[model samples]
Target: MNDELRERIEHEAEKHALLNAVKHDSEADVGAVVGPLMGENPDFREYGDEVPGVVAPVVERVNELDTEGREKRLEVVAPDQLTELESEDETDDRALPDLPNVDEDTDVRMRLAPNPNGPWHIGHARMPAVVGRYKERYDGWMLCRFDDTDPETKRPDLEAYDAILDAIDYLGFEPDEAVRASDRMETYYEHARALIDHGGAYTCSCPAAEFSDLKNNGEACPHRDKDAETTREEFEAMVDGEYAAGEMVLRVRTDIEHKNPALRDWVAFRMIDTPHPREEAGEYRCWPLLDFQSGIDDHLFGITHVIRGIDLQDSAKRQGFLYDYFDWEYPEVLHWGHVQIDAYDVKMSTSTIKALIETGDLDGWDDPRAPTIASLRRRGIRGGAITDAMANLGTSTSNVDLAMSSIYAANRDRIDDATDRAFLVRDGVEKAVINGPETGEPPVHPNHEERGVREIPVEGGVLVEPDDVPPNGQRAWLKGYGSVRHTRDAFEFTGDGIEVVREEDVPVIHWVPADSNHPLRLRTPDGDVEGHAEPGIASYDPDEMVQFERIGFARIDRQEDDRTVAYFAHP
Candidate 1:
């Protein structure tokens, strides 16, 4: 058993003991329960509720001691639970598809190939995690392959590639090897040549436009009847650039009468005139189709497992056919469904979004509305929270509607403990003058004394949110500390209040002073609005997510430049 897991079980026991004693209104030995595993296991956050009953008494005992005694005796585990403690260790470390008893002799390898069409989206981020998680669970390794084929569609952008690798690194996955399909063209050609030699494939003279009509009517190509030797010669000629782009294609001899016509004599190779990213630009009449290349790669790489989204499940079967023809061993295939993002009619394609950013129609990939990883980070979302959210969405064939608000809520929970309180002025109006030293500075956060507070100093003038500015003869509470009254062009408050602005008579929003220049802004869904708070407004640390009193949570985007400080308005 690993030391980490052993310590976690014992720690849970101690916590249980302390809580029980504390509930009884007695001094509990928190130290005894928390000390043993404190340094050993930094990973254990909160134990799941399904802890063993045997450990409950240990926690209760720890809680019964006085504070001084508790500190000395608060060992996580008693000496008695060693065997079960080891069992707990194994369980905690175990991952899903639970392959604990796999024979050590069996070698397992897998591959995760992502298409380099655009920046990897959140949906694709889960791909590497799933592969890596399963690989760790089964004690296997996985290859990271760049499926950069299709010269007409593939764009060679190092930035996108680096971003993908960075995201993979962020997810803690290291590929056993990295491969690009574009680099293996020669290998694909060898397989194509072998298929032609065996008479399983032949060159077709049918025009590209005729494919649909032929598939629909079960019409055979004119080149189908040519002898194997003659077809081979023509295929070689085609590869050597003897034919026009659409003059001929190499096709697998499949059942033309099959119910699904897509499988009927599908093209195994095609002629493309486009300049290749890796290969020298020449007349390339022989290009292995996607399904064909993937099949060959699986064999050469010895991929034992293939986990991809359900969208590609059929690709697995198509490649399986190629494997059977080539007498290659098939890998175990697992299909995860797509993440149907709830975007409220936003174009979900990464290409469109990228175009918008590049063309200056949108800010950048990190724009909060873009839904990229950088965007999520800028919005103060936690990586673990995204992982946890995806966990709730199991590997079922069904898709889940992941609302944007749900993601924000998860982020909010993660930063709740770490963030400080801030006051922001969204829409402001000057309140009645307090031209004296009677009003003191307001604290940054109420109730968090240890975090202490930054002062929002009171001057001759104070800015109140436009709604908070009451009409003549009304009272309004300033929330958290106190209340004040508003009269004709003046403001006053009494601890024993007579009359001015009554709380019921006036409803006002909260805002900081306009002239203090503490550097803050009210960020709305449309755009950011720059504003200022009272002088010496609380110091907001970078990336520190805080809730402005009554204005919602906003993270401090800048420290040095007051005008550049941006806020993410809470939805």
Candidate 2:
């Protein structure tokens, strides 16, 4: 082959090798690599009679390059094109049910209203995924509404506002528009005034305890009889801070003898002395409650549907009263029961989790023990896996109590094919002296040979996990090497190659050159485990997932020189 032809072949071969490495494969088939290049550049296949000879040298050169280096080059060459390699045939079984009454002119809109009191946990994550699926199905809009009006009780945090957005984006759901309840205080006030003018709401000056007692006895507060003109003046006074924090509140008028006492004269707007973290501190004292604020925003934002937890049915009922007073149609409401994973001991309350984080009882939100989306992302769980799990749950209203095994199983299925395999020996290392070739190269991935190989300089000593070292005289197979017998302080070589010499279910243990392994500290749900990983691990970027030969999959959290920190994802 001419030098120019040789150079062209070698360059295309390098690109193909990089593509395989980027997918975490050991290698690509010669045809898989060559066909794409030929399709992209017809000149590469111009050599009619000498095609095999030209391709043979190019393949050899490609295989000789390091897998890690190829991955870096691939990132530079085609950053946007590199995606997870999942088989197309691996279809999701749970498809979204068809949305009702959606058509070309239908402006389908939904909102994920999260209280910005704390970071989003796993339970809170499903809402966005569920609504996002519908949004996709209808080609509609999603509004990320921050229900931050309960500043005194729930206490909105400035950082949590952005954190919620980040979590939603991490789940692969981007809102079409974002709104904050604190920003729309004037709009709520207008609605409150309108409600008062219609005699549907009244200002209650009775002490909270007294009102609770009267409401429990099916009696209205003394102020409930005041005319609209009087209530409007009291509401104006409330806006002007004439009353102390709990001395007065605007309550929506409802059936005094309603079966649910909570629905009787529910508080619509109240005074909070605590200043909001994000908004101008103490600029406005009167704040709208969730029911009033959501009820107003739903109409203003043109929301066509509302999907929330079944526990919030009372809130919907309370909001419906406001809708009736204004003669406004309420959006279609759907409630799903709570999902509980039995494996978690932590209550899925954002407030409780925030308190735990503050007291240092747990690590920050991304701690493996916490079920926040940040923690899952840090632990290397893919967004697709989370969406798939949510889809599988469907639109069931019945409460679900399941084990973590199903989630891990779903995650494993999505990630297994793309995760590169490496040797990681935990709980300290043991030396295995093998009597074999001085050097070896194992394919980086077992299924794909074109991905490349990892160099192993085997001058004798190989590092193996202490547990993998069998009892004296017992046989064990050194992965990528050969079968060996355990002797005192050393592994005596008993076989010639990787082929099995004895067939009594000998354990296949991964090993690395004793001096070449890097220190790896893995944080798991149970606790931390220390180990040594093959040096190739250093090449992985933070958040990249990799499988430990016999151990489970782990995502690299960070790397500092020779030490690497990883979070155990799943088995």
Candidate 3:
């Protein structure tokens, strides 16, 4: 254990001891101090049967002090630390700001519409939490809409649909209803006809290059001037397969001379021959563009709030025209700026990551290197931590690049109080024969006596990491055991009891009985690290998060009869 962690454990134990001492009007009981200390610093509970030995001295020291001295010691511990502990018991009811124009009578509805082309990454995962917070705050309904219309470009994969749903479910946001755009083709066609009938949209037969040149020159295509009836005929002909793909396109009647070229005469629908994976193959050819479909769906689905990334601001602008054409009220749209993680070597793009997965450059969507929600979850990052991190970012419009350290710190704060610790020797392992009692049992958690103990049969040598073994005669501490002197061949136990060495520079390391260890394969973000883990590790369930003594935390992935696989989470 590092000195920092040890100090924290001691500090927490002292606080508990002081509280117990004052409550009983006598010296603090070892059990009273150990229980609350373990509750506060769960990592200490890893000491198992040795928890009593580790905390007994602290309890004895507190007992040696008089009531006045105990009061003085309590004062010495910072007041803020005590306040922090007290605040922890209070519930976190913090919520997002209320939506605009919403009241008891106003129906507040939101939707998380995602293209089912790939698995949801960390970037995609933020929406559900943001929307879910709003949903709870306003008691609104949330819809999970799959925008799987463009099969030619952002092609829909059958597996991706379920994967997206699974990702949303993992985030703990259960949508009130689920809808698919592919299933509502006729609705989009109806809207297209209405637009043509109202002269709000037109069918253009101009060749792609010619229309692009005309639009660039601030001129309209000949087809753009065609009458509503003529445009309707062309649209029907195109939809009936009379026209080959790209021979005609349905363009919403935006200004041809608009400052933004893309905003000028945007394509509402286009012909694509690529077959959709889910819907009947080639049953539909004319696909509605994302903006067109989303606009129609949002209004039709009674969505009152549209929360999405600022990149979709153009989509909202295009949708505004359609809303105006239909004489419908546009939903309140809120766009948040991009969230960038500074630790990522490359900006996380779904399409780029998908290509990497296809090329076998990555293991899968859940590969630790990827920022997918699955990857984070696989690395033992809790969903609550993810939500907390996002909430901390708060709805800021400015693009922010956050450090991975900040994210991991938030996660560590959450899991630290619950996760237990264990011992593992990485790289080359050296055997240390301690000159101590024949057998020992230490509490699995220094603070949690109820977790029971692990038997350490001293007849077998204890396994220690090679780097932790100091030079000859240098004092070192075997955690859960006492102080020892490192020799060339073995660690000579130099203490008679489990007393913590006050020497600040002495290194402390975790150890496992050589005979009671099994081979461990730890999958880290960098690569697989081979090590020897205590036999007790086999009892942990898959996905259980545990801190490796003197190492970082890891998630148990699986355990076969002989070999165990784990994923390194963070330090």
Q: Candidate 1: global Cα-lDDT?
A: 0.60
**Per-residue lDDT of 1-571 in model 3, one digit per residue for the tens?**
5667667777777887776665445666454455445644668867634454445557767877998787778768755554443454311134355577887898789999988888887877678878877777678899999999988788887888788888777776789999888999989999999999888999888889999999998899888888999889888876776767888899999889988887889899888877777745458888898899999999999999998787878888788889899999999988789888754553488888888888997888888778788888898988766766666665667786655554565576566556777878876466557667655565676546798777666567777767667788786677766677877778787874433443244555677777878888988777788988877788899999887764567899999888789988775
Give candidate 3's TM-score: 0.83
**Candidate 2 C-alpha lDDT tens digits along 14-95:** 5764675455455443333444455456676565324433443344444555776655666666555554333222223344
Q: For candidate 3, which ten residues in a row score worst on lDDT?
A: 86-95
Report how far residue 49 has shifted in candidate 2, in Å.
55
Ranked candidates (TM-score, high to low): 3, 2, 1
* TM-score preference between candidates 1 and 2, better one: 2
Off by over 4 Å in 2: 1-95, 100-105, 496-503
What clash count goes with each model?
17, 7, 16
The residue-level lDDT of candidate 3 at 177 comes to 93
In lDDT terms, how accurate is model 3? 0.76
List, residue by residue over 298-336, the lDDT tens digit for candidate 1: 888887777666787667766665666777778777776
TM per prediction: 0.72, 0.81, 0.83
